[model samples]
Target: MRLPEHFLNNRKLESLVENQSSFTLDHAAMHIFETHQQAEQVLLQFDQPVLASMIEGKKVMHLRDYESFQFLPGESLVLPSGELMCIDFPEAEYENPTRCLAMAISEEKITKVLDWMNETMPKTGGLHWGLMDYNFHFVNDAAVFQILQRLVFLFTEDHPYKDYFVDNMLRELIIRILQTNELKIYGSDTFTLRENSRLAHVVRYIRTHLHESLDIATLSKEACMSASHFHRVFKNELGISPVEFINNERVKLAVSLLQNPEISIKEVYMCCGFESRSYFNRVFKHKQQITPGDYQRLLQRSMF
Candidate 1:
């Protein structure tokens, strides 16, 4: 959702019937699509694995083996090589068009990362570190979204070391996707399935005690490892510190509380396990880029 400002302000999304634009790098390319008419059953396919995200408007996606669903902004879909997709733009118009981006990553680059993972960070089960064979759909979490935003910027921006920058970003995006898939499979659906995995163990403890006081020492105890070792491996596995993850969870709780006008903003911090108003405000603003009071006012304005 980190659309370029120029694109947002004064875009000439005209003349072209389909409106396809591209920005290509050595290892990665971003293909943009915009539809100006009501289109049904538009077939799209990619030669390489792509992370497709909805930037604006909506799409009815019909993957090969999955059920048809509405793909909206803030959602991402990862497709393997040569996966065919049938998309429907039910609400596209001249003024309100459906826009999406297909981030095609090279096969050689993906293989390099997978080889590293299989050798260095293999899973507990028989599953190896490979891309999902089928379609993988997920809500865009903050970490994943931030990486996507950066990748988009890197793809479009003209930097001297653009390839180097993109390689790092692509590597980051791959790791995040892999960890997300692992969590989707083992952490959420089958928590008991991988009790032996220290990473999964710590993730479970974090989710269960999201509102409770969480510390690296306590989480390391749950993982049965030293605090230092836990900190290193946890970052390697999940791409964030243990305390940042806890704060993210707390902010999630705070957002849910803020939806209700009956609850005062002063009460939300304590209910979400924050210690004080100043700390809560700082963390909330840091995470969401807005203070709690402004968020409350925005929500109120939206409800009107």
Candidate 2:
């Protein structure tokens, strides 16, 4: 998304690099940081938990205990309140400046959301819903990207009810982030060994039986849950329905299968347990924004 010309022109020339512009609401604040020259070991910290996303250019993040990694656009990192960040801008220039946005969220707002989640959502292994208390860096998914874009608009736009709009979006954004953290943990290969979480066992079962016909009843039995409760818990925990999760796993399998040049599209879909080619095409297109055939063709072309 492009910054408005007025916003760009109106920024105060406070510093050559890491110039900051802030917009505040009742429960949160948004900040835009632009760096116009090469910089090293730039220090940043937040008094409140912050969700930081790269808008343009690159940054090398230096965090304790982890190797420095490139922070690029379309990626985000969540830091707990007061966590220090050491960032480097190696490619900032007058013509191509590095830009990033940080949304600092109030503890009250976080508590409200966490209360609602704990009251409504049920987690396996007797875990309660809480924001992970460490650094979480990930590439933004579609839902996350959409919410961030809306947040940028809400933060910058002039409106009579801007606070109300931002509050609602903040709740949603927090939920999305929490769900993403859950997915990251439960969706990993290491999580399968965690026997206390029935959901993890269910995920393992789904992976092993991905090429077979799967039904809610069978999966519910695996989790020792009733069908209705299973569906509700799964969706509440993962923010996606069982059918959606199964299809997603199937699509992942189809992607791996398509890597083999010898596989036909029909065979790929069949082996991934898709019911029919047309249905597979629809689901794959919806998930990947590209048809399987097109993806395969592109892959083949890249190979050659």
* Candidate with best TM-score: 2
For model 2 the TM-score comes to 0.87
lDDT of 2 by residue, 114-151 (tens): 99989878577787898764688988888889889888
Measured against the true structure, the TM-scores of the candidates, in listed sequence, are 0.72, 0.87
Task: List model 1 lDDT by residue over 213-267, tens digit each.
Answer: 7788898888878999888766665556777767877888888889898889888
Can you tell me which runs of candidate 2 are displaced by over 4 Å? 2-6, 158-161, 192-194, 289-304
Task: Quote the positional error of residue 265 for candidate 2 in Å.
Answer: 3.4
lDDT per model, in order?
0.80, 0.89
lDDT of 2: 0.89
| Poorly placed runs, candidate 1 (over 4 Å) | 1-17, 23-25, 117-128, 132-134, 141-165, 183-192, 207-212, 248-304
How does residue 64 of candidate 2 score in lDDT?
72
